[model samples]
Target: MDGYRGFLGLLVSALLVGFLSVLFTLIWVLHYREGLGWDGSALEFNWHPVLVVTGLVFIQGIAIIVYRLPWTWKCSKLLMKCIHAGLNAVAAILAVISLVAVFDFHNARSIPNMYSLHSWIGLTVVILYILQLLLGFFAFLVPLAPLSLRAFLMPLHIYSGLLIFGIVIASALTGVTEKLFFALTKPAYSTFPPEGVFTNTLGLLILVFGALIFWIVTRPQWKRPKEPNSVLLQPNGGTPEGVEGSMAINFGKADSESNNEAAARKRNLPLDEAGQRSTL
Candidate 1:
């Protein structure tokens, strides 16, 4: 279908670049720096980069585009929302732990916290991310908020999510550069040392990954079709049987119905059946 054109290719490319960025991050910490650890040392600080890239950069990116998956269109929007929120929650947890590692490392060494420009931006982004998560859960996931509120907040929620993801990439880039400058004294960063070159490449990979995610989520045609009460989703989401039976009837007539008839039926249906007729 025209809606799905280039979706698979773009999705695959995003996945490949995302994983590669994660792998390069591991290599930087393990091979180039002092490997991972939990103690309040530079080793513990290594977890900061690893977790940020894995959680904030990679997993959060996946969450942003989860709604765009074509296969999941047959599933309930509620279930998809849960999956999306779950991914964001995990990313948030990792980001918090990464912050703890930084604070611990600094405290142990008597270094000041939130001193650098990168630290200021990173902390602000993390706080904004938590706020976004909480507001989204209440407005969209729970039934407490009215439709008008959800509609009003939807654009803000989307824009803030992408903005946070962009800031995360910026934070990662600046954080790495600051680390190189501090760590590379004998072979200064300006000398284009091996560590500087490698980290610069890592920064480029992160930029590419962020760009792909933004492109995937922003495209209008790639948005998932809305079929909230469809029978196809009931098997996985436990939708009410009555709702399933009614949706089944509509799917049964989909093949025989003319385009106008289908559109009329969709409008008249209780669940707002906006998915493709051929899919039904």
Candidate 2:
């Protein structure tokens, strides 16, 4: 779309890298290591990397940028907020499951847990991610927070989302490196064995994917434009009716109550002009 230059190409590249990262993870586990299982074998351990890469890394990246997609601008803001919260909830579930897989595998083999920097940072990221999800859901999506408070938290929300994403990528890189060191001693990772090369490539793809996501999200020109007459601004929608009233009450201070109601009833509002003001 004409909304932002370079966004389309960058988004396509990010998707390609994200899919490759997941596929390469699967190949590494199935072809090079034991296939997935849940009996507390090394197979069970395979689920950790796959779930983390797929759900935490790839899906979370998508969730972070969903609002920036120009095509989805026509949808209700409340709908987009729900989609965002749902995706993050899914990512949180997968992260917790992956942690369970790791702890279960460790306990079965009598291997110590929470002993590595990766584990420590990973746990912290997951906890913070859940907290962010809950707070954002309550603040913006639920309309409990005033417009001023939502506006105040918006910057922090964006910053924390990106920060959590970067930390997850770093933890994944360390996890894969740790795996290589422990699993490839037979051929010695320095020998450049096939698995070593393959896993290294996977790590690189993940890193590139993370970098692309950061670049796409941080670009000011790529931000989703504000929609003044959105469902979040209307009073007749089903679930969003409450959200609309909250917006009218909190953000409509520049005009009198009657004027706010008059403006809200006008369905002929132009997008270009409406895009100037931000409600959420």
Candidate 3:
């Protein structure tokens, strides 16, 4: 299980690292295009599609944290069960929202109001998501916490949350800035270029930092003293016995009345009977 989990963690970490790298490269490309004074044709206002997809990603990020919390805290089984149910409920709602966005986008349906709504709501969600992540971290220190919960999910939660934050913040900033620019200047993509480069670079830096943190937290240390083993049974008729006493008691004759009677009968036998008994 540990090996499987380690593989999963490495896979996720690699994917996130790759994603951040791509995002950074794109951001740089966008900035370079803008610096070179290229027309906004290279930049389009099609981020709504990306936003819808990424919003679902954000939801996944939140779900990971929420699902992990109870396990990390070693909460009561009932509480953990309840939390699982609640998280599932929230995930269902988000899933519906994501589906609606997908269909809406496909049908060429534009909700100008929804654009603002999704933006603000997403920003709020990201903030809470970050807070939940912070709390999820505390779960690691508690030994009673489930290993799968911490070892497998925690790093993903951290990395995913950071990535989501970067993406959402960039999306929000670019969105608001573009809107303002359009309101003031004009509806030309030339006025403001996509800031993907800066956002991506920021995300990469965050991923690196997160990796460093994970290493620091999970590094091995000297072993702790084990609990003293409890004595489950005793020798010498239930009395406490040290090692030597326990050995002696096992090797000695029975201390019961039956053994004493048998000894007395042997001693009382006549010499001839004793000799015959001994020969027998």
Candidate 1 CA-lDDT value: 0.88
Model 2: runs farther than 4 Å from truth?
1-5, 230-280
Number of clashes recorded per candidate: 0, 0, 3
lDDT of 3 at 144: 42
Looking at model 2, the pairs that clash are none
Q: Could you give candidate 2's per-residue lDDT for residues 17-80 as a string of tens digits?
A: 9999999999999999969999998999999999999989999999999998998988888899
lDDT of each: 0.88, 0.88, 0.43
Off by over 4 Å in 3: 1-55, 65-74, 109-194, 198-280
- Predicted candidate 3 versus true structure: per-residue lDDT over 1-280, tens digit per residue: 2344553464466446535543543454354333222122322233332332233333333333332322234444335435533553454454445344434543453435335654566545545554543445355433244444455665775575556545544544444444434333333444443343344344444445345334322333311112233222333254332343455455554556668888888787777697898999
TM-scores, all candidates, are: 0.81, 0.82, 0.27
TM-score winner between 1 and 3, please give it: 1
**Candidate 3 Cα lDDT to native:** 0.43
Of 2 and 3, the candidate ranking higher by TM-score: 2
| Root mean square deviation (Cα) for candidate 3 | 16.4
True-vs-predicted CA distance for residue 144, candidate 3, Å: 28
